[model samples]
Target chain A: MESKRIEQLLNKYLNAETTIQEETILSKYFTGLEIAPHLEEYRALFLYYAQSKTEYSTQSIQLKTKKQHWKWISAVASFVLLISVYAGYLYDQNKQAEYAFEHTQDAFQLLSKNLNRGTNAVMYLENYKTATGKVFKELN
Target chain B: MNQAEFLSVVMPFKDKVFRMAKRLLVSIEEAEDATQELYLKLWKNRKKINSYKSIEAFAMTMTKNYCFDRLKSKQASNLSLVHNNYREKGLSLDSKTEISDSVSIVHELITKLPEQQQLIIQMRDIEQYEYEEISEILEIKPTAVRVALSRARKTVREQLIKQHNYGIKEN
Candidate 1:
């Protein structure tokens, strides 16, 4: 009688019409030692299913914490990289400004020296003008 | 959710996820990698995890997609050399020791099925998910899941019986 029920359930299972409960019954029936010889061909298949269910991954699952830890570390590393890059850029700009300032100061010094030479020429001209005026007065 | 809460909720189904991955990828190591990848994805999207109705279904769907992507990229790169190697390795790994020769034949038969049928068998027969759950994970109608599952079961059955008959004749 039990074997008859098993046969029906197995048929239903093959047709994909069996409920989970019915399928469970069928799997349980196959696991037993007394499976009818005519039905014995399916024993390996059912046994495979049963064994397959036991195949939990022995590899440990790495939780989010460990992975998140890596995430945090990488984020910090990238942030530090960005900050140093920006700082180097700022330092370069400051150096460029100082260089420009030094070049301009040198340019101003050269211009002032030329102007002083021109002022000395103007002083010579003034002396010449005074000497000519005194000669004109002696002629008068 | 917080990490602890998310872990408590999703950890219970980790094995199921791994099994789904293994079924698709066929190599334990590949499956493990896929499982790890899936979990990392889940963790990254933890904020939206609760929005789904079934976390298990969502995780299984993710596993399926991720494994398929891996297989596609692998095929693109290696021309399926590693694919066959993994199938052989999986057969050997599964058939070692007390497992009979017939069992390995079933494993081979399973690998021969299409990806959809393979997943259906893995979930319905081995993992014993309900049709509703299978439908949700596969994003197919329940009737379609049943039809595919029935076809898969019948194919495995016919092939296994034929192999058994041949073995008996040889002996």
Candidate 2:
């Protein structure tokens, strides 16, 4: 409290012999508004420290990298998902086309077989007409 | 730890980290950047945060290392001409300028000290760290820390007295 005692503490502080509590006393002493004239020179140093303690990072913290990385991963994942969905769609379309073509081929083969039978039947009928006319001619 | 937990654990000392960085660095912007970078790192290593006895000390050590590395960079040296430039709003212009001048003088005198002493003062006086904590941050013996801090404060005190007596660098 007294300048004499403060001076003693300050000396101890300069020697780094003071305990943490004692050092706090010195810091608190120098920090007051009314410093003794002889000790005024030391005021700025303590004031600077006190002033610095008040200095803080007012800018809001933005830990962007981690969030950005997760965003990037999601983007890539969605991109892969889109590609897979498109690929699956294309594969399904291809299978449906192949199945329909196979059915059409089977139906065309059946149609051609029946058409061949019809052709053979017409040929037999034509031969029968010609033979029947010949027999008629012979009879005539 | 997760963001909320990491923030709760480390947020209390973020300003302390900022001040430490500000002390080492020449500019508030650089200090702010360093503080953010330090927290980002702490966040990344949040899982390991519990391993250290005191997260604030760990953060201060990280801040010290980061700022020192920054000081070595060409840009930081260029920026060293600037120091704390904040204002006490209600003061008259003359006293404001006077206080600012005195503040810069102490700050400049501080910057000229050997880097170790300057760091010790910052840790001991400005940051008010425990001797053990300062020792851990500086990676030195507690006795050595006390010696360095003594030397640092004496140098500043003598220079300040000389300046006040003769007005040598006042212009």
Candidate 3:
């Protein structure tokens, strides 16, 4: 195509007025082995576009691999979080049980001490009763 | 869709996604990060995405938003300059030797433009997206997309011509 025609097409391209066929023609023109000196600057841009397609860099793949590892790490972290929460709950329950056992033991100790004191008072009263009965028989 | 179905649907667009991210971020590393992030975002918001007419548009928008969010946060932290320099260094190291000098120059110039213009060029030129689709992805009027694209292409062409002359003079 002539320079003027190409320029016109380029203008149309800029205005988004070019049809797909025209775009394909423009792309073909730019990709041709021969390009004008003035239009050389645009050759790269068009060529880049023509060549621009989906590409995956090895580095990107590596990054993706690392991301996969991170997913596993995050999953593990979540599992650990759950386990920690459960352990904390179990710890609280054990503490409550221990507290209840200690209180029960204290209450039982208090009852046994009072029962022994009551028995000792009863024994002293029994000795006094026996001594008073002997004194009444001697008087008769 | 299920994971396999979603992956198959999106697998065809991986290059498109990569190019979009590469254009937006100007770094392969950042682009790769952005791609994975975009995919994760898609997976997270897959429910809402069913309403979208074009999954490609949806993915592109998500990628753009993610890149802008990172840029904004970096700016807010006052680390934009430092981060930019660091990114430049990384890009230099990871630059594709296969790409021609003109392509590299064009890519660099595109990065110099405002984000909106850059995005418009990418959508129209690189991705071959229609004006209506671009509008939907950008949430702008279709006319606005055309106008921005025209101005962006003009600027790019101008820059390319100037750079070409400078190179000839240097030679």
With candidate 1 superimposed using the best TM-score fit, by how many Å does residue A89's alpha carbon deviate from the native?
Answer: 6.5
lDDT of 1 by residue, B1-171 (tens): 887898999999999999999888888899888888888889899999999999999999999889889988887797677777886787678657467888877888998899999999999999899999999999999999999999999999999889888988999
Could you give the CAPRI-style class of model 3?
A: acceptable
Which regions of candidate 1 are displaced past 4 Å?
A: A1-5, A63-118, A121-125, B44-48, B73-78, B95-98
- Name the top DockQ candidate: 1
Give the candidate number with the greatest TM-score: 1
Candidate 2 residue pairs that clash: none
What's model 2's overall lDDT? 0.80
The lDDT for every candidate, in the order shown, is 0.89, 0.80, 0.78
Candidate 3 residue lDDT tens string, A103-140: 99999999989998998999998988899989999999
Ranking by TM-score: 1, 3, 2
Return the top candidate by lDDT: 1
Q: Which residues of candidate 3, in runs, are more than 4 Å off? A: A50-140, B47-49, B89-95
> Candidate 3 — which pairs collide?
A54-B15, A55-B15
Stretches of candidate 2 off by over 4 Å are: A66-140, B75-98, B168-171
| Model 2, span B1-171: residue lDDT tens | 678887888888878787777666656677788988897888888888899998888888888888878767745467433332422221232254456777667877887888788778877787778899899888889999988888887888899998888774655
